[model samples]
Target: MRVMVASLAAVLLASPALAADPVQGRWITEEKDAVITIAPCGAKLCGRLSKFLVAPPQGIDQRDVNNKDASKRSRKLLGMPVLTGFVENGDEWRGTIYDPKSGKTYRSILQRKGSNQLTVKGCLGPFCQTQTWRKAG
Candidate 1:
């Protein structure tokens, strides 16, 4: 029926630009300390800390004591969302990245380089730090 055809078309047409986003995957941080997985979340893409390669000083079962929000301080860091509110912007995705160590949030931009590397930039106004993340194995 036309209704069935329209529904199928709606789903297909709704799936646009982001369907082939190469940056949507797991990546190892520059320090090789953790693995973050990037995936679609709502209207934008978000990355979450999926695994810890090295245990924190507080051990593997660490709580987010450094979190600025008192209510969230007791939360666990594993599976915590590090990158959020990211939306496609040309060759890069701009968003916010949270540093669990510092308990601060910074503006972040992400771009994929080649097939195995991703450039992550965290910015504080005019100054920015860059790190290259490798594809997670």
Candidate 2:
């Protein structure tokens, strides 16, 4: 049983449990446009556009026509991952955020403020735009 116990301990130390991160949940965007669900994808954390609270110009079932890649243009917007490669950085998260409207991806910094608020920063060079997202009910 000693070897079995050692193996179990090693496995636990290797992979982080998803539930340990408080950011793993649904959040309302700063604009209240859509609900984003932040969850574990592969070995990292990713945030996806899960639900639309407001309809866009093309409606809820719209395709990703604004994507830079022609092949990905036909993909649907809902359930699309806007935040990818997010990993724990001290108390915050560092990741890449994709903007469907601009067809661009930016360096993103996610810092949780208080219990219900999260500050998301999308950076370009030294300039960054910040937005506050609230935990969804």
Candidate 2 has a TM-score of 0.83
lDDT tens digits by residue: candidate 1, 82-107: 99999888778999999999999999
Using lDDT as the measure, which candidate wins? 1
- Give the C-alpha miss distance for residue 72 in model 1, angstroms: 1.0
**Cα lDDT of model 2 by residue, 30-124, tens digit:** 99999999999998999999999999889988888989999999899999999999988777899999999888999998888878998889999
lDDT of 1: 0.92
Worst 10 residues of 2 by lDDT: 16-25
Q: After aligning candidate 2 to the native by TM-score, how far in Å is the CA of 58 from where it should be? A: 1.5
TM-scores of all candidate predictions against the true structure: 0.83, 0.83
Angstrom error at residue 84, model 2: 0.3
**lDDT value, residue 39 of candidate 2:** 94
Question: Least accurate stretch of 10 residues (summed lDDT) in model 1?
Answer: 14-23
- Candidate 1 Cα errors over 4 Å, as ranges: 1-21
